[model samples]
Target: MLGQKNPPVDRGQATAIIVFILGLGALLPWNFFVTASLYFKERLAVNVAVNMTLNMVVNGTHAGHTKDYNFDSWMAFLSMLPLLLFTLLNSFLYQWVRERVRVAFSMVAILLLFSLTAALVRVQMEPDTFFSITMATIWFINTFSAVLQGSLFGMVGLLPSRYSTLFMSGQGLAGIFAAVAMLISVLSNADGINAALGYFITPCVAMVAILACYTLLPHLEFARFYLNRDETDKQPIEKMPIKSRDKTVLKNSEDPKDPEAPVLQDYKLPEKHTHNQPRLSVFAVFKKIWVMAACITCIFGVTLAVFPVITVKVQTSYRGYTRWDKVFTCVCCFIMFNSMDLVGRSVPSLVQWPRKESRLFPVVVVSRVLFIPLLMMCNIPDSKLGTIFSHDFAFVVIMALFAFSNGYFASLCMAYAPQLVRSRDCETAGALMTFFLALGLSLGASISFLFGYLV
Candidate 1:
C-alpha cells in the first residue's frame, strides 16, 4: 500500500480536450464568417442581371453599372450590433431562460441560419435582396452566437482556472481552423459559389460536435467536482445550519476511499459566520475587472478595425510565383493572423507576462494602436496613404506581431478576470467580460469602416 497510485482525475485530459472543443465550438461560427469574407463579397458584388448572365454562360464582368454594395461596411455594422445587444441581454435573459436552454437554443439557431446561408450560395438573387437577406442572417446568427459565447465563458469560469485558459485557446484554434477552411474553400473549386456551398456546411458539423460536448460536460467527473464546489462556494456560510461549533479536525488523514490521495482534514461544519469577502454587486464586479475588460475590449476593437476590412485589401508587390498572387490575401492575411493568434493564445499556458494587476499590461495593449497605422501603410491598393511596407514579408511580419499581442493580452485579461473577483462573482465577471469584448467588437467594427475608408 506504500506506493499505490491514486485514480486519475481528468485522465489523459479528456475533460480538458472537451473543454477545448467546446471553446472551439463557441467561436467557430464567427471564425467561419470572418474567413468567408471573400465568398460573401463575390456573391454580393454582382447585380441580378449579372448573376443571370453568369448562369447562362459561366462568368460575367464588372463592366456595367454595378450595385455599390460595400459588403465590408454592411457586415461590420450588422454583425456586431446584434452581438453587442444580445450579449448584454443574455445576462438579463438568464432570468427567463435557463442557461442550458439558452445555449442549446442558440446553437440550434446558428445551425438553421448557416443552413440558410449555405442554401443561398447556389441561388442568385438581386444584389439588393441578397445583401438584405445576408445582413439579416448575420444579425440573427450573431444574436444567437453572442448568447452561446457569453454563457460558455461563464460556465468555464466555474471550473478551474486552467479550463478558462483552455477555453480561450480553443477559440484561438477556431480562428486557425476557419483560416484553413478558407484556404480549402477557396482552392477546391474554381467556382466561388460552389466552394461556398461546401464551406458553409463545416460549421454545421462543428455545431453537432459542440452540442454533444456540452451535453457530455455535465457527465464528466472532473467537471462535476469543480462545478459542485462552485455551487458550495456561492452559498453563504451562514446558510449551512451548523449543528455544533465544536469541531474535531484530523490531519494527514488518508481518504480511505482513495488511499493515495491525502485528505487534509475530516471535520464538522464550523459555526455560521460571515466570510470576509462580501458578495459584489454587478457594478462592483465590473469595477474590479474594468481595466482588463477595457484592455480586452480595446484590444479586440483595434484588431477588428484593421483586420480583414483593411488587411484583406493589402497587396504584396513582391514578384511571386504567379499563382501565389491570387491567394495572397487568404494566405498572408487571414491564415497568418489566425495561426499567429492561436500561438499567442497558447503562450499564456506557458508564460503569461505583464501580470494582470500590473500597470504595464494595459500599456502594452494600448501600444498595439500602432498596428492600425502600420497595417494601413502596407500595400493596400488605391489607399489615401501609399504603401510603404510594400512587400508581403513586411505585411506578414506586422500582422503576426499584431495578432499575437491580441491573443496574448486578451487571453490574460479573460483568464485573470474571474480570479480578481469573489468566487460567486467569477461567472458574473466572465459574462461582463464577454459584454466588454462585444463592446470592443462593436466599436472596433464601426471604427474599422473608417479605417477601411482611410486606407
Candidate 2:
C-alpha cells in the first residue's frame, strides 16, 4: 500500500519559493556591486577632479566612466573575465567537490565579501589602492557566484521545468531590486559612504536568510520526493538489482546535527541501477541539448550587444521638453526594460508559447537578433544613418519589446535544456547549459564595442 502511494504534494509551492529565493541570492550580491555606479565613480575620482576636467577639456572626450577610474573599465573587463572563466570552470567543479560544498562554500565566501565591501565603505584610502582591493574582491565574488549559479541550476533541473522558470524569473527580479535600491539612494541624497553601507548590508542579511531556507529545503517531503524521484518509484528499493555497490549508500543520508534534514540525497548516486543507465559525459549532454544551447547563445549574444551600450545612446528627441531628457535614459532604458523583463519571465507560468519541442522556439530566439538593428537605428545621434525611431514613445516601445524578448526567450531556453536529456543526464545538461550561458555573455560583451561603433 505504501509503495503504491502517490508522491507528496508540494503544499503551498514552498519548494518553488525556496528556488526563487536561492536564485535571487545568487545574483543579489553582484547586482548591488554593479548598481552603485555613482558611488564608485566618486570614490575612484576623489583626487583627480582638476585633472579629470583638464583631461576632458584637452581631449574633447565625453566626461564619463570611460575616462574616470570608475567601474566601466575595471568592472566591465575584469569582473566579466573572471565570471566567464569560473563559470566555465564550474561546469567541471562537480567532479571534485560535493554539491553541498559547492553551494555552501560559495554562499559563505560571497557573504564574507559582502561584509568586507560594507566595511570598506567608510574607510578612506587612495583611489589606486582602493581600486586594487576592489578589483580583487570583484574577481573572487564572480568566481564563487558562478559556481553557486551552476550548482543551483543543476539541482533545479532535477525537478520540473517551472521551477527553472521561477529561478530565472527570480534573477530578473534581482535586477529590479537593485535598481529600486539605487533609485532610493539617489533620491535620498545620503552620503556615498552611508548609502554604500546600506547597499552592501542588504545582500548580507538576505544571504543569511536564504541560506537558512536552503538548509530547511531537504527536510520537506515535498522536495525530497522530487529530488530523488527516480530512485523512490512505486517499487521497493529491495527489488532493484544491487550488483556490486554497497546498499548502505541507499540509507537515508540526512544530516546528523539536524537529523530531520535530508541534505545529502540531492548529491547521492543510486545504490544500484535498474536499467543500467549510461553515464553521460558533459559533451554528450551538450549534444542532446545543442539546439536549445545555440538558441540561447544567439538570444543573449544579440541582447548584450545592444542593451545599455547602445540603448543609453538612444536619447529623447524632446531634450528640453519637460525635463524628460535628464531622466529619460534611466527611466526608459534601465527601469522600463527591467520591469517589463520581470513580467515577461513570469508570463511563462501562465503562457509558454513556442513549446520547447517546437521548431518555432529556435526561430523566435533567432528573430531577437533583429532587435539589435532596430535599437541601432533608434534616436542615436552617432548613427550615421540618423535616427529612424524619433519620438520618446518610439524608444520606450522598442525597449519594452526588447526587454520582454530577452527575459522570455532566455527563460524558455533554460527550462527546455535539462529536459532534452535522460533523467540522470538532466543535472549535467543543466550545468553545461550554465557554461554556454556564460559563454554567450562573453561573446555578446566582446561584440558590444563593435556594435557601439556601428551606431
lDDT of 2 at 2: 24
What lDDT tens digits, residue by residue, belong to model 2 across residues 344-416? 8777877888987798888888888888888888988868767888888888898899999888888888888
RMSD of 2: 7.6
Each model's lDDT: 0.77, 0.77
Task: Write candidate 1's Cα lDDT for 332-404 as tens digits.
Answer: 9988888888888888878878987689988989999999999999988789998798887899899899989
Query: lDDT for model 1, on a 0 to 1 scale?
Result: 0.77
Error of 2 at 84 (Å): 2.1
> In candidate 1, what residue range of length 10 has the lowest lDDT sum?
237-246
Tell me each candidate's TM-score: 0.85, 0.85
**Candidate 1: Cα lDDT at 143:** 87
